[model samples]
Target: MTEQSAPGTDRLSSVATAARILREFGKHSTQLGVSQLARRVGVNKSTTHRIIWTLVDEGLLERVEETGLFRLTTTMRSLGASAETAQRLHEAATTPLDELRRYTAGTLHVAILDGTDVLYVERREGPGAIPVFRSVGSRNAAHATSTGKVLLAFLPAERQARLVEGMRLSPKTSRTITSRPEFLAELQRVRRQGYAENRGESEPGMCSVAAPIRDPLGQVVASVSVAEQVESVDAGLRHLVAPIVETAARISSGLGWNR
Candidate 1:
């Protein structure tokens, strides 16, 4: 038996709900009330109430004191700065991605972390590239993708724990790491090795490797990945390591990461 505690399903469920509630704010210009947030996110009012208060406690939101509405705090504004970074990250990765595509003849992707998911911001298919059923705006669970694992492995420990624990780790394939301990261990390996790999974890027959892209502050902000369809999970992985790492380093340097 796994003895992992239903993998804390509700813990992550609530987290995902909180994320949805927060995103609803982006669609509006003013402060929002619990009822409106509930209606928009399709959650009951009471649950939305708790989630908002939790966000308030976390300092991402602030209560209006008199009107009982909630507004984003300065903390959120600081976090929102990443949106600009995302644009720059896209620009930074473009030339590197083009080079990687020509060099590897595989599908290349660049992604940014968004809550528990890795949002694909750019995708390119080289000659003989494998078809990965995702696009510029599509998203995938971080636990399942090489790009997502790279992002997760580089996150601050406390925030990483919160996110990894909250994730359900549902199996996407026979090799998916559905156990939290196992997944954490894998992340450790990824961090130590400075890259991450997917051996048909996200989809059968698809294998990928990714490396982290860091900003000027040396914080990892995105990942560059290349994937191919292979007969075995291990096929070509050894050769991919250096080239993918080189590609990521180039992209990171373009973003002003010195190391």
Candidate 2:
């Protein structure tokens, strides 16, 4: 029993150490070396080398032949694929997004919260639409845009405060809301109304309106927004587009989102 337990404990320790090493490597992938990784992870050189060698063997880490530096492997692609399959937010939002684009004749975007940022997962550009600055795979600050505001409004207050703490509310345009108190008030209003809007806050003359897409359980899982040039967005345009944006949220909700 003792002999068996000894190997098991050792294996667990190695795994713990390996996980730490991998985390450090991920944070500094461009310039990570075995010595630096060992120091950062609080493990000794020999153990770090053994752990790295094991990860490299498993194709989770790669060694650059030229500089002998270590980085993540192509196997990370498989992890990303698995995440995409699991999330399915983009797939769920597709049809509604098409309808939104048809209704608004502007750019429609679907995004999910990633840490303190919103990651664009899908987009549909309308015919004759002006080119948008954001693209799929781009990330934007959560406190500064419409989609981000809707999503953040749904999060618990503590979580929202924690996420925004130390984050710069950088001004992207003269119209952008950068003060934390004002931004928090806006988020509260979004929570009450079930949607949010931005008037050229991210980019000059680019206005956007967004609604939260919730799961069946009422949890905000993503957001859908329509962006257009400010010159084109009048009071009449808001009346036409808001309902379409809400409709898109409903469609995404039907795809298994709750709230």
Candidate 3:
């Protein structure tokens, strides 16, 4: 009788087999042969062939010069480099983030644009931190937060346009910008002002101000923001711009951004 598996077991096993095959590459060799990999991973030659081609299509692996040998691609190297850079970015932001939170008496955030969402990577809470943003590893809509706006504002024009074109523009509050044309105009204003604002866009009575953090190449890699729940949010967030911009600059400098 054929062995039975639960629903989706075949897909899960394929994924796990693919992962095992990938791990096998660096352990004993840089380039692997299909038959050799199949023997090592204990998968059938046919299944291993299918998974290897899938990885090749995804640019994770490439065949070696008309040979059966397969090796990891530059895409794998880039993915590894990105992981290291993300760690360095958090380390570079720490002292500046703490100082900014203390100086401004507001909760500080460091975020990156993740797809159409803003992924919060670091946070320092002051006494005035808003109740809604108490966690560091949370994600929020990109169109409804200051950090998201600042990161989006600094993106290259064509890429930014494409991203905006694909956005759903879902609203979190009445103050959120939900129109593509108006959102594009807002990004233009942010580019001119060199900062962005959130006036109760993500949460009721919450306000924030944000500026871009650059890498060594002067490309915007992240954003820093000061957020709080204020009674008079519109005017209250203005003063934070100076300190937020300065702190962002300090973090950028720490990351070796000279321009």
Candidate 4:
């Protein structure tokens, strides 16, 4: 009788094997041979060969034709670059965001556009911070927040359309923009004004103002937002716009946004 793995066991084992192979590659500063890699990971030569070939096929590793050695590929370099960019964005935004939080006595956030949501990368709160709920690494719907609006507003129209196409508009508050046409117009206004404002749209008592953080290419890569209670914001929206825009601009400058 032949032994059989419980359902999904083979797939899980393969995944573990692949992960081990990738980890072993990281331990080396140079290309690794199949036998050497197998010895390091304590896997059979054939299993190591299979995992290495799979990784190479997936662009995670590259094989040297002359030496038959395998090494990490440019894919890892791209991943590193992405991580560095996020880290730089967080580091660069910290001081300015803190100052803005202090100035406004509210919460400040630095967020990146992730698909149809906003990914909070950094956050600062002052003594007068309101009771809104969000944290670093939190994700919020892109249609319901100031940061999300600025990010979506700066996107190319076709791209924006694709993101909203056939998507159900979920309502978070009575003030949230639900219709596609109305939301599109809101994005238009946000693009023209170079900022976005949320007024009791995300949460009943909360408001936020946000401006885009641009890259050296003039592409919006992240956003800076100031969030406070609605009562605290209604009277000061106009005054708040200038400083928020300025803060985002300064952060963008730090990120190499010249224009």
Identify the candidate with maximal TM-score.
3
Candidates, ranked, TM-score: 3, 4, 1, 2
Which is better, 1 or 2, measured by lDDT? 1
Worst 10 residues of 1 by lDDT: 125-134
| Per-residue lDDT over 107-160 for candidate 4, one digit per residue giving the tens place of the 0 to 100 score | 888888777888888888756664554578889888989999999999898998
Worst-scoring 10-residue span by lDDT in model 2: 232-241
State each model's CA lDDT, in order: 0.86, 0.75, 0.87, 0.84
Which residue runs does candidate 2 get wrong by more than 4 Å? Answer: 1-82, 85-87, 128-132, 232-237
- Writing each residue's lDDT as its tens digit, candidate 1 over 157-183 gives 999999998998999999889999999
Clash total of candidate 1: 0
TM-score of each: 0.70, 0.65, 0.77, 0.75
lDDT at residue 31 of model 4 (Cα atoms):
85
C-alpha displacement of 64 in model 1, angstroms?
8.6
User: Candidate 3 versus the native: TM-score?
Assistant: 0.77
CA displacement after TM-score superposition, residue 45 of candidate 2 (Å): 22
Error of 4 at 83 (Å): 2.5
Summed backbone clashes in each candidate are: 0, 7, 0, 0
Model 2 TM-score, all chains together: 0.65
Task: Supply candidate 4's per-residue lDDT for 28.
Answer: 41
Question: Ranking under lDDT, best-scoring first?
Answer: 3, 1, 4, 2
